[model samples]
Target: MIEGRVWKYGDDVNTDVIFPGKYTYQPLEPAEMAEHAMENLDSSFAKEVKKGDVIVAGYNFGCGSSREQAATCLKAAGIAAVIAKSFSRIFFRNAINNGLPVIELEDGVDDMEKGDTVSIDFEAGTVTHKGNAYHFPALPKEVLAILNDGGLIPHVRKQLGRE
Candidate 1:
Protein backbone atom coordinates (compact mmCIF):
# COMPACT_ATOMS: atom_id res chain seq x y z
CA MET A 1 0.00 0.00 0.00
CA ILE A 2 1.18 3.47 -0.93
CA GLU A 3 -0.37 6.73 0.17
CA GLY A 4 0.55 10.24 -0.83
CA ARG A 5 -0.59 13.78 -1.57
CA VAL A 6 -1.87 14.31 -5.09
CA TRP A 7 -0.30 16.52 -7.76
CA LYS A 8 -2.98 16.51 -10.39
CA TYR A 9 -2.71 17.15 -14.15
CA GLY A 10 -4.65 16.72 -17.37
CA ASP A 11 -4.31 14.44 -20.41
CA ASP A 12 -1.46 13.89 -22.86
CA VAL A 13 1.39 14.88 -20.57
CA ASN A 14 4.36 13.91 -22.71
CA THR A 15 7.91 12.88 -22.00
CA ASP A 16 9.37 16.27 -22.87
CA VAL A 17 7.11 18.05 -20.42
CA ILE A 18 7.69 15.42 -17.78
CA PHE A 19 11.41 15.91 -18.20
CA PRO A 20 12.24 18.50 -20.83
CA GLY A 21 14.10 17.44 -23.99
CA LYS A 22 16.72 20.17 -23.60
CA TYR A 23 18.18 18.55 -20.48
CA THR A 24 17.95 15.06 -21.91
CA TYR A 25 21.44 15.28 -23.40
CA GLN A 26 23.11 16.31 -20.20
CA PRO A 27 24.74 13.72 -17.95
CA LEU A 28 22.50 14.54 -15.04
CA GLU A 29 22.39 12.70 -11.75
CA PRO A 30 19.03 11.50 -10.45
CA ALA A 31 18.66 14.50 -8.14
CA GLU A 32 19.56 16.81 -11.02
CA MET A 33 17.02 15.13 -13.23
CA ALA A 34 14.43 15.65 -10.53
CA GLU A 35 15.11 19.34 -10.46
CA HIS A 36 13.74 19.57 -13.99
CA ALA A 37 10.75 17.30 -13.65
CA MET A 38 7.58 18.97 -14.90
CA GLU A 39 9.49 22.17 -15.66
CA ASN A 40 7.63 22.45 -18.91
CA LEU A 41 4.23 21.43 -17.68
CA ASP A 42 4.31 22.93 -14.17
CA SER A 43 7.21 25.21 -13.52
CA SER A 44 6.66 25.07 -9.77
CA PHE A 45 6.40 21.29 -9.53
CA ALA A 46 10.05 20.40 -9.05
CA LYS A 47 10.44 22.88 -6.26
CA GLU A 48 7.19 22.12 -4.47
CA VAL A 49 6.94 18.35 -4.74
CA LYS A 50 7.42 16.41 -1.55
CA LYS A 51 8.54 12.85 -1.01
CA GLY A 52 5.74 10.32 -1.40
CA ASP A 53 3.63 12.70 -3.47
CA VAL A 54 1.36 11.09 -6.07
CA ILE A 55 0.38 12.41 -9.49
CA VAL A 56 -3.23 12.02 -10.59
CA ALA A 57 -3.71 12.72 -14.27
CA GLY A 58 -6.29 12.34 -17.02
CA TYR A 59 -6.44 10.08 -20.08
CA ASN A 60 -3.49 9.41 -22.37
CA PHE A 61 -1.10 10.48 -19.68
CA GLY A 62 2.48 10.09 -20.80
CA CYS A 63 1.57 10.25 -24.44
CA GLY A 64 4.76 11.18 -26.23
CA SER A 65 8.20 9.94 -27.18
CA SER A 66 9.32 6.78 -25.47
CA ARG A 67 11.99 8.35 -23.40
CA GLU A 68 12.68 6.40 -20.20
CA GLN A 69 13.71 9.64 -18.53
CA ALA A 70 10.06 10.64 -18.41
CA ALA A 71 9.46 7.90 -15.89
CA THR A 72 12.88 8.26 -14.34
CA CYS A 73 12.56 11.94 -13.60
CA LEU A 74 9.19 11.52 -11.90
CA LYS A 75 10.52 8.72 -9.72
CA ALA A 76 13.58 10.78 -8.90
CA ALA A 77 11.36 13.71 -8.06
CA GLY A 78 9.94 11.62 -5.19
CA ILE A 79 6.73 10.66 -6.86
CA ALA A 80 5.60 7.51 -5.11
CA ALA A 81 3.17 6.71 -7.88
CA VAL A 82 1.21 8.09 -10.84
CA ILE A 83 -2.52 7.48 -11.10
CA ALA A 84 -3.97 8.27 -14.49
CA LYS A 85 -7.10 7.55 -16.44
CA SER A 86 -4.91 5.92 -19.10
CA PHE A 87 -1.29 5.74 -20.15
CA SER A 88 0.87 5.39 -23.20
CA ARG A 89 1.89 1.72 -23.39
CA ILE A 90 5.59 2.45 -23.71
CA PHE A 91 5.52 4.89 -20.82
CA PHE A 92 3.69 2.35 -18.67
CA ARG A 93 6.37 -0.27 -19.21
CA ASN A 94 9.15 2.25 -18.74
CA ALA A 95 7.64 3.33 -15.43
CA ILE A 96 7.56 -0.19 -14.03
CA ASN A 97 11.08 -0.88 -15.24
CA ASN A 98 12.21 2.27 -13.52
CA GLY A 99 10.47 1.40 -10.23
CA LEU A 100 7.76 4.02 -10.66
CA PRO A 101 4.31 2.70 -9.89
CA VAL A 102 1.75 3.83 -12.47
CA ILE A 103 -1.85 3.05 -11.57
CA GLU A 104 -4.64 3.40 -14.08
CA LEU A 105 -7.77 4.69 -12.43
CA GLU A 106 -10.33 5.16 -15.17
CA ASP A 107 -12.71 6.78 -12.72
CA GLY A 108 -12.54 9.09 -9.70
CA VAL A 109 -10.08 11.50 -11.27
CA ASP A 110 -12.70 14.17 -11.31
CA ASP A 111 -13.21 13.68 -7.61
CA MET A 112 -9.58 14.14 -6.81
CA GLU A 113 -7.98 17.56 -6.71
CA LYS A 114 -4.47 18.85 -6.27
CA GLY A 115 -3.17 18.30 -2.73
CA ASP A 116 -5.83 15.73 -1.99
CA THR A 117 -4.65 12.77 0.04
CA VAL A 118 -4.92 9.40 -1.67
CA SER A 119 -4.08 5.82 -0.87
CA ILE A 120 -3.30 3.05 -3.30
CA ASP A 121 -3.29 -0.60 -2.47
CA PHE A 122 -1.45 -2.47 -5.20
CA GLU A 123 -2.34 -5.83 -3.74
CA ALA A 124 -6.03 -5.08 -3.91
CA GLY A 125 -5.85 -2.87 -6.98
CA THR A 126 -7.78 -0.07 -5.38
CA VAL A 127 -7.23 3.66 -5.17
CA THR A 128 -8.92 5.33 -2.23
CA HIS A 129 -9.57 9.01 -2.50
CA LYS A 130 -11.53 10.99 0.05
CA GLY A 131 -12.86 7.74 1.50
CA ASN A 132 -14.03 6.37 -1.86
CA ALA A 133 -12.27 3.44 -3.43
CA TYR A 134 -11.74 3.13 -7.17
CA HIS A 135 -10.56 -0.08 -8.74
CA PHE A 136 -8.10 -1.11 -11.43
CA PRO A 137 -6.64 -4.44 -12.39
CA ALA A 138 -4.09 -5.58 -9.90
CA LEU A 139 -0.51 -5.61 -11.08
CA PRO A 140 0.92 -8.98 -12.01
CA LYS A 141 3.28 -10.65 -9.59
CA GLU A 142 6.21 -10.36 -11.99
CA VAL A 143 5.71 -6.65 -12.33
CA LEU A 144 5.24 -6.28 -8.61
CA ALA A 145 8.49 -8.11 -8.04
CA ILE A 146 10.31 -5.76 -10.34
CA LEU A 147 8.87 -2.75 -8.53
CA ASN A 148 9.62 -4.28 -5.16
CA ASP A 149 13.24 -4.79 -6.08
CA GLY A 150 13.57 -1.22 -7.28
CA GLY A 151 13.24 -1.50 -11.06
CA LEU A 152 14.44 -4.01 -13.67
CA ILE A 153 18.17 -3.55 -13.34
CA PRO A 154 18.14 -3.93 -9.59
CA HIS A 155 15.75 -6.85 -9.80
CA VAL A 156 17.96 -8.54 -12.37
CA ARG A 157 21.05 -7.90 -10.31
CA LYS A 158 19.43 -9.51 -7.31
CA GLN A 159 18.24 -12.48 -9.36
CA LEU A 160 21.79 -13.01 -10.58
CA GLY A 161 23.12 -12.79 -7.01
CA ARG A 162 25.05 -9.63 -7.78
CA GLU A 163 23.24 -7.57 -5.14
Candidate 2:
Protein backbone atom coordinates (compact mmCIF):
# COMPACT_ATOMS: atom_id res chain seq x y z
CA MET A 1 0.00 0.00 0.00
CA ILE A 2 1.25 3.46 -0.94
CA GLU A 3 -0.18 6.39 1.00
CA GLY A 4 0.63 10.07 0.77
CA ARG A 5 -0.51 13.68 0.65
CA VAL A 6 -2.04 14.64 -2.70
CA TRP A 7 -1.07 17.67 -4.81
CA LYS A 8 -3.35 18.50 -7.72
CA TYR A 9 -2.46 20.07 -11.09
CA GLY A 10 -4.09 20.75 -14.42
CA ASP A 11 -3.34 19.46 -17.93
CA ASP A 12 -0.31 19.91 -20.19
CA VAL A 13 2.34 20.19 -17.51
CA ASN A 14 5.25 20.11 -19.92
CA THR A 15 8.92 19.37 -19.31
CA ASP A 16 10.15 22.94 -19.85
CA VAL A 17 8.28 24.03 -16.76
CA ILE A 18 9.27 20.88 -14.93
CA PHE A 19 13.01 21.45 -15.24
CA PRO A 20 13.02 24.80 -17.04
CA GLY A 21 14.98 25.10 -20.30
CA LYS A 22 17.52 27.42 -18.76
CA TYR A 23 18.58 24.98 -16.07
CA THR A 24 18.85 21.98 -18.33
CA TYR A 25 22.53 22.49 -19.19
CA GLN A 26 23.63 23.12 -15.61
CA PRO A 27 23.66 20.11 -13.34
CA LEU A 28 21.59 17.10 -12.59
CA GLU A 29 21.49 17.61 -8.85
CA PRO A 30 17.87 17.11 -7.87
CA ALA A 31 17.94 19.29 -4.75
CA GLU A 32 19.11 22.39 -6.61
CA MET A 33 17.35 21.62 -9.86
CA ALA A 34 14.10 20.95 -8.03
CA GLU A 35 13.89 24.67 -7.34
CA HIS A 36 12.73 25.21 -10.92
CA ALA A 37 10.31 22.33 -11.23
CA MET A 38 6.86 23.65 -12.09
CA GLU A 39 8.01 27.22 -11.70
CA ASN A 40 5.98 28.34 -14.66
CA LEU A 41 2.87 26.59 -13.41
CA ASP A 42 3.37 27.29 -9.73
CA SER A 43 6.40 29.07 -8.39
CA SER A 44 5.84 27.79 -4.90
CA PHE A 45 5.56 24.15 -5.93
CA ALA A 46 8.89 22.98 -4.58
CA LYS A 47 8.34 24.65 -1.23
CA GLU A 48 4.76 23.46 -0.89
CA VAL A 49 5.45 19.83 -1.75
CA LYS A 50 5.90 17.48 1.18
CA LYS A 51 7.72 14.20 1.31
CA GLY A 52 5.70 11.17 0.15
CA ASP A 53 3.08 13.37 -1.53
CA VAL A 54 1.65 12.17 -4.81
CA ILE A 55 1.14 14.47 -7.82
CA VAL A 56 -2.30 14.16 -9.34
CA ALA A 57 -2.69 15.88 -12.68
CA GLY A 58 -4.83 15.97 -15.80
CA TYR A 59 -3.96 14.55 -19.20
CA ASN A 60 -0.71 14.91 -21.18
CA PHE A 61 1.45 15.34 -18.13
CA GLY A 62 5.14 15.81 -18.83
CA CYS A 63 4.67 16.53 -22.49
CA GLY A 64 7.78 18.50 -23.50
CA SER A 65 11.49 17.83 -23.82
CA SER A 66 13.24 14.57 -23.07
CA ARG A 67 15.24 15.58 -20.07
CA GLU A 68 15.27 13.07 -17.27
CA GLN A 69 15.94 15.93 -14.87
CA ALA A 70 12.23 16.61 -14.75
CA ALA A 71 11.70 13.16 -13.33
CA THR A 72 14.78 13.52 -11.15
CA CYS A 73 13.53 16.74 -9.61
CA LEU A 74 10.16 15.26 -8.74
CA LYS A 75 11.77 12.24 -7.14
CA ALA A 76 14.27 14.43 -5.34
CA ALA A 77 11.41 16.59 -4.16
CA GLY A 78 10.21 13.39 -2.51
CA ILE A 79 7.22 12.73 -4.70
CA ALA A 80 6.19 9.11 -4.26
CA ALA A 81 4.27 8.85 -7.51
CA VAL A 82 2.39 10.74 -10.20
CA ILE A 83 -1.22 9.90 -11.08
CA ALA A 84 -2.30 11.35 -14.38
CA LYS A 85 -4.87 10.78 -17.07
CA SER A 86 -2.08 10.49 -19.64
CA PHE A 87 1.66 10.88 -19.91
CA SER A 88 4.25 11.60 -22.59
CA ARG A 89 6.07 8.48 -23.72
CA ILE A 90 9.56 9.67 -22.91
CA PHE A 91 8.62 11.06 -19.52
CA PHE A 92 6.86 7.84 -18.68
CA ARG A 93 9.97 5.85 -19.50
CA ASN A 94 12.19 8.28 -17.60
CA ALA A 95 10.04 8.09 -14.49
CA ILE A 96 10.24 4.32 -14.45
CA ASN A 97 13.97 4.41 -15.05
CA ASN A 98 14.39 6.71 -12.05
CA GLY A 99 12.37 4.65 -9.58
CA LEU A 100 9.38 7.00 -9.63
CA PRO A 101 6.06 5.36 -10.30
CA VAL A 102 3.61 6.97 -12.69
CA ILE A 103 0.06 5.65 -12.88
CA GLU A 104 -2.15 6.40 -15.86
CA LEU A 105 -5.76 6.49 -14.76
CA GLU A 106 -8.49 7.34 -17.20
CA ASP A 107 -10.30 9.59 -14.73
CA GLY A 108 -7.86 9.94 -11.91
CA VAL A 109 -7.76 13.73 -11.76
CA ASP A 110 -11.52 14.04 -11.56
CA ASP A 111 -11.70 12.12 -8.30
CA MET A 112 -8.70 13.71 -6.62
CA GLU A 113 -8.59 17.04 -4.81
CA LYS A 114 -5.59 18.94 -3.60
CA GLY A 115 -4.35 17.77 -0.21
CA ASP A 116 -6.57 14.71 -0.11
CA THR A 117 -5.08 11.56 1.33
CA VAL A 118 -4.58 8.84 -1.28
CA SER A 119 -3.76 5.17 -1.08
CA ILE A 120 -2.61 3.01 -3.97
CA ASP A 121 -2.41 -0.77 -4.25
CA PHE A 122 0.22 -1.52 -6.88
CA GLU A 123 -0.40 -5.23 -7.12
CA ALA A 124 -4.12 -4.69 -7.57
CA GLY A 125 -3.72 -1.54 -9.73
CA THR A 126 -6.27 0.32 -7.70
CA VAL A 127 -6.36 3.81 -6.26
CA THR A 128 -8.53 4.55 -3.25
CA HIS A 129 -9.58 8.02 -2.28
CA LYS A 130 -12.40 9.09 0.02
CA GLY A 131 -13.76 5.55 0.05
CA ASN A 132 -13.85 5.43 -3.73
CA ALA A 133 -11.88 3.03 -5.89
CA TYR A 134 -10.32 3.99 -9.22
CA HIS A 135 -8.71 1.44 -11.43
CA PHE A 136 -5.71 1.92 -13.72
CA PRO A 137 -4.27 -0.24 -16.45
CA ALA A 138 -1.80 -2.72 -15.08
CA LEU A 139 1.86 -2.16 -15.84
CA PRO A 140 3.78 -4.66 -17.92
CA LYS A 141 6.04 -7.17 -16.23
CA GLU A 142 9.25 -5.54 -17.49
CA VAL A 143 8.15 -2.11 -16.28
CA LEU A 144 7.14 -3.50 -12.92
CA ALA A 145 10.50 -5.17 -12.61
CA ILE A 146 12.27 -1.85 -13.21
CA LEU A 147 10.23 -0.15 -10.52
CA ASN A 148 10.60 -3.08 -8.14
CA ASP A 149 14.36 -2.94 -8.28
CA GLY A 150 14.45 0.82 -7.77
CA GLY A 151 14.86 1.65 -11.46
CA LEU A 152 16.63 0.18 -14.48
CA ILE A 153 20.24 0.71 -13.48
CA PRO A 154 19.86 -0.92 -10.11
CA HIS A 155 17.89 -3.75 -11.60
CA VAL A 156 20.64 -4.38 -14.13
CA ARG A 157 23.20 -4.37 -11.35
CA LYS A 158 21.19 -6.89 -9.39
CA GLN A 159 20.85 -9.14 -12.41
CA LEU A 160 24.60 -9.07 -12.96
CA GLY A 161 25.18 -10.00 -9.35
CA ARG A 162 22.88 -13.02 -9.64
CA GLU A 163 24.65 -14.12 -12.80
List runs of model 2 lying over 4 Å from the truth: none
**Top-lDDT structure, candidate number:** 1
Cα lDDT of model 1 by residue, 79-158, tens digit: 99999999999999899999999898888998899999999988888999988999999778898899888899999999
Model 2 / residue 104 / CA error / Å:
0.5
lDDT of 2 by residue, 79-141 (tens): 999999999999999999999999999755687898899999998989999988898988999
Off by over 4 Å in 1: none
The deviation in Å at residue 74 for candidate 1 is 0.9
Please give the RMSD to the true structure for each candidate, in Å: 1.1, 1.6
The global Cα lDDT (0 to 1) of model 2 is 0.89
Return the lDDT, model 2, position 43: 81
